[model samples]
Target: MQRFTARAVVVGDRAGTVVPDAVLDVDDGEIRWVGPAADAAPAPDAETVDLPGVLLPGLVNTHSHAPMVLFRGQAEGLPLDRWLGEVIWPREARLTGDDVEVAMTAASAEMLRNGVTTSVEMYFSPERIAAAVTATGARAVIATPLIPLPGMPPLEEQLQHSVELAAGTPTGGTVEYGLGPHAAYTLPLSILTSAAAAAREHNLLLHLHVAETATEGDELLARHGLSVPTLLAAHDVLGGRVLAAHCVHMDDADLELWQEYDVAVAHCPASNAKLASGVMRLREMLDRGIRVGLGTDGPASNDGLDLLADARLAAQLARLREADPTALTAAEAFWLATGAAADAIGRPDLGRLTRGRQADLVHVDTRDLRFEPVGDKEDLLTHLVWSGITPLVRDTWVAGRQVVRDGVCTTVDAEALRADVAERAARLAHGG
Candidate 1:
């Protein structure tokens, strides 16, 4: 058992600063108590911490490539199509399992240091990624990449591996398993059918990149004579409660298809804007009451795995999309990153500071350069979303364990991870 207290904590919305000096007790990897410090009875056997910051629920990243940390800043300034065909896929074809482990380890560490507790990742060699997640103590929904490129093996090989990893790790892990079928044009109809069937049997979420760019949408329509959603629905893969990465190029029909089939969207604004894929009418999705969550896409695409930064960028982009300063408020963006995202991903108990939920939380210091002049709780939240510079995340906890403290990675040798990334980059640079 362990116990701690935050001087001031944000308990979701409308319950601002409920616990001025709040106590949080963790027992056997669960939060047993969370209330005022004066009301909490002392547990003599428990280790105690005194958090000198504002405590809030940890952020949930809906979509990312955790191993792409190795490729961060290496691929940039190109649209999603050229970026993938020219830079990403070529390097991806050469990566080994060991390379994946090193990269995911460093990525997971960076995510934890910035207060992200759960990640939904899709990439190659996810077994190595699962191992890194296990060692890092972060939660993740890890999906195997099913690229339909030439010389690639059949889906069954990766299918077997994904099943094995999922069965082995459900909880107490850095990641579990899910289905990732790359995208529409890349994966044939037969492969989509197989993935959909596997997803149904396994009861896992199928994550795919669809309508990410106008060119992709145009090509798919030219070849198949159907929109991305229509083609997938015909193949019996669009529905079944899946996570679609980008709906930027989607039409009213495609949007209506999501409403009928109940699909969640992972809006990656930074990635979309950086690649000039065009904004995906984020406000339009919200207005339709569609399930929308924030995603950093991949570190290579976004240049980092910082969820707060993503939330802030999401807010800014929403305002840009609507041409209104108050398009997406700070609290609303916060919900998108936290509770809304958790609910979108089927984790209702997550993204809120309450009893019986997963003991995943972040502590942010208000005494920082970015958070000065915090007048009200809403203002504090505004700072969190709009002005959180350099991460006030002094500590990050996942499943009742302090995985990162004082902005340092507890489970990983940060310096060694840095060196390992350098080595991988060198080897890949020289084609060794």
Candidate 2:
């Protein structure tokens, strides 16, 4: 058992409560208690660590391709279609299992140092990805990509592999698996419908990209005589549990369909803007009572995995799109990265500092000028959302295990990992 005393604790619950002079107790990888330090009375033999900073739930990234760290900064200014077809897909075709393992290892370390404890990963090589996550001690929900490509197995074979992975990795642990159908543009209607049926049969989360850009919607509508969402509805693909990413081009009808189907949206504001995709209708989504959460998309697209910066960008974009200063509050943005993200991914046991929740927390050093003039508990969250950076994270823990301390990752050899990735990335860049 262990107890941590901090200056403040941002309990990322539904009400967004904050406790000052907080004490958090952890036992067997679960939070045992959370309250004011003055009221805590631990056993005599328990260990205690006093910290001079604000404690908050570690950020949850609702969508990402973790192994894309090797492709970061490649195809710099290209839009989504050219970027994927010309740069990304060609290189990804040559990726091996070891390549995915090393890249995801570095990505896990980077995310942990930035205070993101849990991430939803959609990529190939699920077993290798899971091995990397296990080695780094990071929590993840990995979804196998279900797109058919040349020189690859048939669609049925791919689906069977995904189901096997999901069955082997059940929920309630540090890792989970799901089905990821790339998108309507890349996959046919039969494949999409079959994937949805498999997901329903296995009771797994169906994650995919949808309505990412105007070009995508235009192409789909021109070919199918219906919008992307409407086409999905016609095939009965939207009736199951879904986590749709990059919903930047959704219309009112699409929004209504998503709401009726109770689909969750993973809003990747930074990636969307970087790729020249329009901003999502965040205020409208919230107003319609739709579930929306924050995502970093991928290191290649966003060029960074900082969820705090992504939160700030989301708030700014929401305000600009709505032409209202109060379109999205800092607290609301913070919630998108934490509690709401967990909900979007269907992980109720994470993204909060409360009894029975996982002991995944981050300690932010508030002694710097970035957090100057700290007024109240509310101000802490505002500062974290607007001014927080990777350097502010002093310590990070996942499931009662301290993965990072004093701004260093304990589970990964970052220096060696970076060197290896540099060589591998160069080879991939040269079309080896």
**Top candidate when judged by lDDT against the true structure:** 2
Residue-wise C-alpha lDDT for candidate 1, range 1-432, written one tens digit per residue:
878777666665423333567888877667788888889886898898778777888788899997887678876677777788887777877788999999999999998888888889998877788788888889888767787665667777766666666666655444568888888778677888788778877778788898888887677788888888998899888666588997888788888888888899998888888888878877777778788888889988888788788888888888987899978877778888787788767777677777787888888877777877866556667677788643678888898888998889899999999999989966775667
Best by TM-score: 2
Tens-place lDDT per residue, model 2, 1-432, is 999999999987646688999999999989999999889885677788788998989899999997999999999999999999999999999898899999999999999999999999999888888899898889988889988777678888888889888987756878899999999998888888998988888888899999898888777788889999899989989866799998998889999999999899999999999999999999999889888889999999999999999999999999999999899998888889998888888888988888999999999988989888778778888888888555889999999899999999999899999998998898898999
> After TM-score superposition, what is the CA distance of residue 350 in candidate 1 from its true location, in Å?
2.1
Model 2 alpha-carbon drift over 4 Å, by segment: none
Error of 2 at 82 (Å): 0.6
lDDT scores in order: 0.80, 0.90
Compared with the true structure, the alpha-carbon lDDT of candidate 1 equals 0.80
Where model 1 places Cα greater than 4 Å from the true spot, the runs are: 12-20, 36-46, 167-174
lDDT of 2 at 387: 84
Error of 2 at 13 (Å): 3.3
